[model samples]
Target chain A: MAGKAVPNATRRSERSHRAILDAALELVAEVGYPKLTIEAIAARAGVGKQTIYRWWPSKAAVLLDAFVALGERAAQEAEGPGSEAPYAFPDTGDLEADLKFVLRATVDELLSPTYDLPYRALAAEGIVNPEIAAEFVSRVMEPSVQLYVERLRAAQQAGQVAADLDPRVAVELVTGPVTARWLLRTLPLTHAYADAVVEMALRGLSPR
Target chain B: MAGKAVPNATRRSERSHRAILDAALELVAEVGYPKLTIEAIAARAGVGKQTIYRWWPSKAAVLLDAFVALGERAAQEAEGPGSEAPYAFPDTGDLEADLKFVLRATVDELLSPTYDLPYRALAAEGIVNPEIAAEFVSRVMEPSVQLYVERLRAAQQAGQVAADLDPRVAVELVTGPVTARWLLRTLPLTHAYADAVVEMALRGLSPR
Candidate 1:
């Protein structure tokens, strides 16, 4: 009986943890990040404020963890159940096709109503608040950007990309323009725009 | 006496207009765009709320005009008084040098403490609010981006850039990455970074 009670307690804790993260995402999407509070998340999750404070240092931490978890869940859904890896940027041995494919998927996600408000809220906060900016980049942005770096490195080895290029900066040639369009709303984010960006990046803007 | 009184009244109205713009800039920097109100701007500018409403339709309108006026003032200062044009993207007839020069100046302006908070406040608001986003993009962003468009077109005409490339999209290759770094804070905004972006954009990621 004593051993069974310990297992039950662990399951309950996990349930509460998941609930807190979900609640944080919901509230931020509904109210925006500036107004989000741990108290509100706790209430929405049916947990105590102390429960949140015990595990996370601030609302930003909770939101970051929630977003990370959301990404992992999204990855799992896109893949299949029991998938171990969170993501694998497609590698078709064709750099242009691979990048265009991934960027189109990114365009879809950015425009998705479910992710749009919450992501924008966090991004808006990060733009103004330095502490949130550092954490957002480290936890969310840097890791995703690393995927492009790895793919670009592979392309370089295959003689598809220039060996001299820094994969980190090279990734930005495709990403930066797409991001600028999305963030600034200068143009509609679409698959065609993504393909154009890939073409311009792979082929020099000056005559080759 | 009546004709002399007319000049005095026009001077007072000009003073009020300048004061309102200045107050809007200062308040937005201090309290951020979310908290800014016409009442507060009027109070700070030593004008009646009716006076503000008489000129501008909304707080966003006031702030937009203030930012535009600020840019005009800064451009005048940089170019000296009586400068006819607001901006001239450098065209030394060297595409790479010209782009790098302009991006470096952009980096400086983005980082300046005087403009940082106010710009961020507007950008942050623009991120989440579609109404603000459209207004901000058209009023502030479009005009500035046009400068890059004009410069790129000149480069293309001179046989420096590929004539086939769209200057609008091509400009994003340089500006997109810089704006991303500024908005996301993924890395430091620096002259060296700008130079690398210019090099990467001009020279394709693929081996020439």
Candidate 2:
């Protein structure tokens, strides 16, 4: 009877964990990050505030985990079942085509309503909060950026990219414009814009 | 007697205006944007909250004006007395040299503690508030970006840049990476980093 109770307890804990994360995302979307509270997250998740405190130190931690989980779920769906490495960068022989394909997908993801609100809220919070900013840079940004670095290194090995070009800095030439346009709202982020960015970065802005 | 009284009134109003702008900037730096209030700004400026309300509709308005005023003040100092067009882009006929100069200055300004906190707070606020974002893009971002466009156009005419390129999009290739590195804090923003970005954009990433 005691062994049966332990399995039941584990299942209940897992259910509560999912509920809390979902609630945090939903509340941030509705109220924005400044107004989001652990108390509110608890109320919506139907869990005690103490339960949240026991698991996470602050609202930022909860939100960060929720976002990371969302990304994992997205990757799993995109890769389909039985894929262990869903986050791998596509490395077709053509660097330009590979970059364009990935960037276009990014443009779509950034503009999607499913990811926009919660992500924007957290991003805004990170901007003003140094601790959150450090966490975000390390956990969310560095990992994704590393994918591009790996792809660029592979391209260099193929002699498609300039041998001396730092893959890290070179990656910025392709990724930064899309991000700046999206963040600053200076122009509409489009597939065409992504394609143009890749073309310019590859071909050079100077007259060939 | 009437003329003298009018001049005195104008002087008093100007003093109050400067005071309010200074207070708003200082308070935002200390408390962050989410907690900034008109009442606090009023008290710090030694004026009633009604005075702030009369001049601006909200705290965001006061903060925006304060930032604009700071930029104007900086421009005046940089350009010196009796300069009408202080905001013009530097065009030395060498596109690489000109871009490197301006971007290096920008790196200095971004890393300055005086500009860093308040500017970042406003930028963070703009991320979550569409209304603020639109206003900022128009009032702050667009104007500075247009300077780059004008310089790039000059380069195009001089046969330095590719004539077929769009100045607006091409400008992003130069500016986007620096802005991304600064905002995301993924790497240290430095003069060397800015120089590398300009060099890479000019030379192209593909082998000659």
Candidate 1 residue pairs in clash (backbone atoms < 3 Å): none
Per-residue lDDT for A1-208 in model 1, tens only?
4778888988999999999999999998788777899999999999999999999988878888888899889988989888765677999999999999989988998899767767777788888778888988887788779999999999999999999888988988889998888887888999989999999999978986
Best by TM-score: 2
Computed on alpha carbons, the lDDT of every model, listed in order, comes to 0.88, 0.87
All candidates' chain B TM-scores are 0.90, 0.92
Local error of candidate 1 at B27, Å? Answer: 4.1
TM-score of chain A of 1: 0.90
Per residue, candidate 2 scores C-alpha lDDT tens digits across A1-208 of 4779888988999999999999999998888877999999999999999999999999989999998889888888988866665377888899999999999988998899778877777677887787888888887888879999988888889888999998899999999998788877788999999999999999887887
lDDT tens per residue, model 1, B35-81: 89999999999999999999998887788788889988988988999
Model 1 bad stretches (over 4 Å):
A1-9, A31-43, A48-59, A81-84, B1-10, B27-43, B48-61, B80-84
Residue pairs of candidate 2 with colliding backbone atoms:
none
| Cα displacement (Å) at residue B81, model 2 | 3.9
- TM-score of each model, in listed order: 0.90, 0.95
Query: In order, what DockQ does each candidate have?
Result: 0.70, 0.77
